[model samples]
Target: MATGDEFPLPGSTYRGPAPHFARFRAEQPVVRVPATGGGHAWLVTRYDDVRAVLNDVRFSRAASYAPDAPRFPGLFQAPPGMIISLDPPDHTRLRTLVAQAFSVERIEGMRPRVAQLVDELLDRADSEAVTAPVDLLGRFTFPLALTVIAELLGVPSEDQERFSVWIRQFAAVDGPEDEAIAAREQLGEYMAGLVVGKTAEPGDDVLSALVRARIGEDRLDVGELIGLGYTLLGAGGDSTACQLASSVVTLLARERDTWVRLGEHPEEVPAAVEELLRWVNLPTNDTSGLPRITVEDVEIGGVTIPAGDAVFVSITSANRDEAVFGSPDELDFARGGEHLAFGHGIHQCLGAPLARIELVLALRELTRRFPAARLAVAEQELRWQPADMNHRLLELPIDLHGKGF
Candidate 1:
């Protein structure tokens, strides 16, 4: 394919994967292409193939960090405690320390509080929406996600805004690299202080739990502790904000009946969230999925990627692969299939349970409040952030007076 065009396979925020992936799935399921980070890398698109690359131990996430290793620019995850960058023993060791907090039971227990927060935010929006429409991205989705993560991590109320500000800057794909670096350092410094505080007097939060956590006699040192905290806070907050916002836009603009039906029957929300996860493809990777190097030759989608070559498996393309998913582009709530939205294998998102809870509860509650909601402005007025990494809608001016969008 001569490293066709550039990489990342261009995608749309509102629409799913660009037409490119479908063609890639049908034709060259595995082909070499130029990556965003300045190198030719293999792009793997079919369903089973993408799943294979994700699960196969031969595809090394850890080794891709070597200076000479070929990789696409993804999460600038080059820190001591970044679990996504680690493999096997190290990843397993760190993940165990904080695993309990996001257990399904723990997250489900947070439902009442999540519902309460949603309602409170809605109440404030209701009062404020006398004439003007509310920016749901700002007022509802972002706040709902930020507050849930902040409270779970025990970020004090006063410091949350600062934490949020730094997080937004750090997560912004559109921002200057230097600014993101500065914000990253700021977040680390703040989290370091928080870790110190947690050590002195622990609280009933994830950070404090980590403060007391130990693997036998070994404990996370200050740098690793800060790194883990940074990873969780950055990932848990902004990613959810972008995803939930994108999902809400999907419901309001595209799937009105599903929205109304869910509003009337909140119990169905849990099931629907799975389909939503499958349907809304965000981190369709602005660069690509933390490129993995093949430890040995890997036969994926019929292509034998030689050992030590960087490969990117497109989850977005896989989720919509017609072979695995019938009528892949159509958003069917009744669809029955496991989707790789949270990813697959050992590295699936640790926060999947919490993300599902937020999506389910937020949508369930939101529909009840604004069943008639539709776009406040014409569809053209809706703006999505430029393609950097994930699909993100910038501002959704939702008219809550009658219905909502």
Candidate 2:
């Protein structure tokens, strides 16, 4: 490795980006590492470089699938019809058509229902904790995230259990590559049937909204629609579930004062959620972010990455950049500032608005309703999934009743 950094670079995951990333940001902001297939890929860690890579059109997301592209070998690219794979005009068109469903009005209108769901989940947790440690991931975060996205996408309740399984399979890094690919296909197939049904009988939901969406003579084909639907479920649902659950774990374990204080002033919950998003390091198996293939020789952080190379931009590191955040590693809810938690540029998360709403509402409710909540077990005792995949506590056991043993 050009930086002498091994894969899964060494660092404590306690606060953010681990310690090694901070060193890379200072010493080798842009360094090369062994690529998955066979070649080398540049790792961009500085906030400025990370943003530059994201904003520069020369770094192409679509090119990542080229047979000869330098990339991590397994699952080198998103399936063709997925939005994450598209670059400019194609990405622009699809996003325009679908963006209406995630608009401010639509997402805000969902607040009441989201609040209701959160309360219901916490109700279960509160009751169950009277007897035993309640698995907060299962009881609160997972279902709230999955249910909201499912209803938004107009997936029938009967079909949603399968949706969760498919998403988990797709998100698992330890699982066989073939199984993950199969899960993607199955999810796509399921979404194909959903589009047909929604097309025939429109519902007041995102998929139906997309079904009716058009541009002049342009409309999304079945493949594009299926791809978008599954993308929302897989990326939106699974990642949000992971982030929200992990945020909760951080609060109960690390920032118990902030956790209790936020409950006292529910209005501060949104700001607190923002800090958590910036602070929590979503554990992954790689030293890379989503890979973008260089369309031309690009200079980021004073390093020249040649054309046809894969560039891995670290959003985690960028969010923790010292130049951008004062005392960058410390989780300061009061220090409101821009961060790359949702990423940057056109490829930024489309479901970000909905996710913010979900996180804000869920946290607000939890803090208010169960202000005495505490971890039932030591932080190390929390069962995290294999580090090969995204690190998420498999189950978060909490004492929701304020009675800690």
Candidate 3:
């Protein structure tokens, strides 16, 4: 087995996609690599092969969490039966129930609020602009994403900070395992109480709506409700924040022209947003996207993956596949094409609509207000966490005064 540990995989130290991903794509697109837990599994790096693993019904995400299932190192296993850990039927049911809150109408109605929130956040960042090099991740993007999800879920403002802290620990890949588990439990307990309270005095928020949402006379139970909350906040908040921050970082560092185009022609922001989503390498290069297991023998790129073998799909590499993308590394909004940043098939991200709205609005406003914004520190000096969950920067020190707002 070629462990590939000799390669520089993205984690804390390496900031971009590991060079090995491209090499693997060329030499061995689908090969067995060491699993994080303790065994060998297939690592699919090519674009088409990744889509196969993601869309094929034979590959089971739910089974990947089985007691005897295999997991890659440092990959956190979601509690069994969690919405993200389920396959059809159960996943279908939960997704349907949760869809009420994130419907197109509901998210579209949030545009004004989203814009308002962006303005408020930028106002704060501008005030701190007196102290050049504001930490965009800590001060803006992270909080903005968390706050949006919190408000959407009807979490009280007073509780959002504490709630976000618990979530950070729970979702963190590098944190202590016990603490992350405890944080998850605490969040579940807190959400349960909140649900009960909302049941008594329902408000105009997602949680309140969730408390009332049903599926053929089957309402969400406390456990399912808590699990839903975890899925929403975890998936919707942390990952989106990291993605938003990385988009900005990548644009400032490598796609300055694209960033300028958005600033000059805000009308193009929507189209530009999609390209940004496709371009930014989530978690790390060759995203350790959601892990799935093969239920039956499956072959991809001429490699046979045995049943029960963990198959890790690299979205980062897929987005850059040379066959699908011309000049794959370049960030060109004109290079419009579908990319699987949101995980391809049935389990595609539920919060994708809202995430797109946030990213588009964020980039639009940031560019309009500070057209001259650039990295305060050199590109190579920027720090990145080494994990496969979301490509996140430790800090984004940026000069917010591009041509003096």
Candidate 4:
């Protein structure tokens, strides 16, 4: 059995790629751990094991509602209609309703707009007289993602900045519990008000579409509606922003030859995005044990996980399992798309198409405009968040080509 000491402290910042995950993958793919009190939980690391747990009906998402569920108590409270926190048939029904607004076809149609937004952001950044030390996280990635999500949800552009603050506060790594709770309440209230407005006057956005969609009588509880709004705003904006910023940083940190190869061959951009997604697995760990519950005693790779115990699946470790990925730690664009970054099975990220579109357009535009752009600071000197949940650069200072396109 493992203990808290056996896992890298959950919130500790890993500066570069995590070496510990590789070590764990080698020694213990499915490890049992002591949870609060005398209880035990399993931590599954291998690709096959993780995928199995994700799809297994016995291991339910409704585990979050268990009376004695051990979770990061302050971070998330189980909310209904949140596809991430529910089990079937509620999960199935909620996902089906929301799925209409998040379809791949709908997301694909927005690619042209995404491209235009990318070009405009780069053009504006280039126009600034002092551009060398601009933080990509702030200037390009965050704003671009925020704009996209805001427009998709029909959120008033004027209200974006205000809501953005609530998001940051709610997700802050080092906030007091009271502060975090306050932020969540504020965000809920704001979203509730917005839903009321949408009800009165429908718009051609996701929120209005959801408000008008028919499921059952109680398809969307009031809390669920507000929670969905908050979830979309936070998840859509934050994840894409981190990915966009990290892609640039990772590309520059690699050998100049690789950057040149990608820049010259635009066809490689999709492959590059996949490689980036594989390499940059930075979602918050599921200490909640909400997704997996042992209905019957199960043995994974010879490790016994007792029935009724909690389990945490490590996607980061799964993505780097040597058996599944050759040269797992190394970035290889030629490698086929097999990474679990968007997860596997029914629980895969709903925003994946949008994320891909944003990434492809951002990378293609940035490289085409500044073929010679390189990192102005050493990797060790770059500032990263203390939270291990995200691999982000606080600042990405780069030297742009003097002659702009």
State the C-alpha lDDT per candidate. Answer: 0.77, 0.80, 0.79, 0.72
RMSD of 4: 3.2
Task: Please provide, for model 2 over 88-190, each residue's C-alpha lDDT reduced to its tens digit, 9 standing for 90 to 100.
Answer: 8889998888886677887788888888888888777777777798888888888988999999989888887899898888767657888888998898888
State TM-scores per candidate: 0.93, 0.95, 0.93, 0.90
Q: Runs in model 3 with CA error above 4 Å?
A: 1-16, 386-388, 402-405
Off by over 4 Å in 2: 1-5, 8-14, 74-77, 283-288
Q: Could you give candidate 3's per-residue lDDT for residues 59-143 as a string of tens digits?
A: 8988886789865556655777677788888888888888876778988888899999999999999999986779999888988
Residue 133 deviation, candidate 2, in Å? 0.8
64-148: candidate 1 lDDT, tens digit per residue = 8788787455444445348787888887887787674456677778888988998999888878778788888889888888888
lDDT of 1 at 141: 83
- Give me candidate 4's TM-score against the actual structure: 0.90
The clash numbers for all candidates, in the given order, read: 5, 0, 8, 0
- Maximum-TM-score candidate: 2
Q: Give the TM-score of candidate 3.
A: 0.93
> Which residue runs does candidate 1 get wrong by more than 4 Å?
1-4, 71-80, 284-288, 403-405
Worst 10 residues of 2 by lDDT: 69-78
Candidate 4 runs further than 4 Å off: 1-17, 34-40, 73-81, 129-131, 216-218, 284-291, 402-405
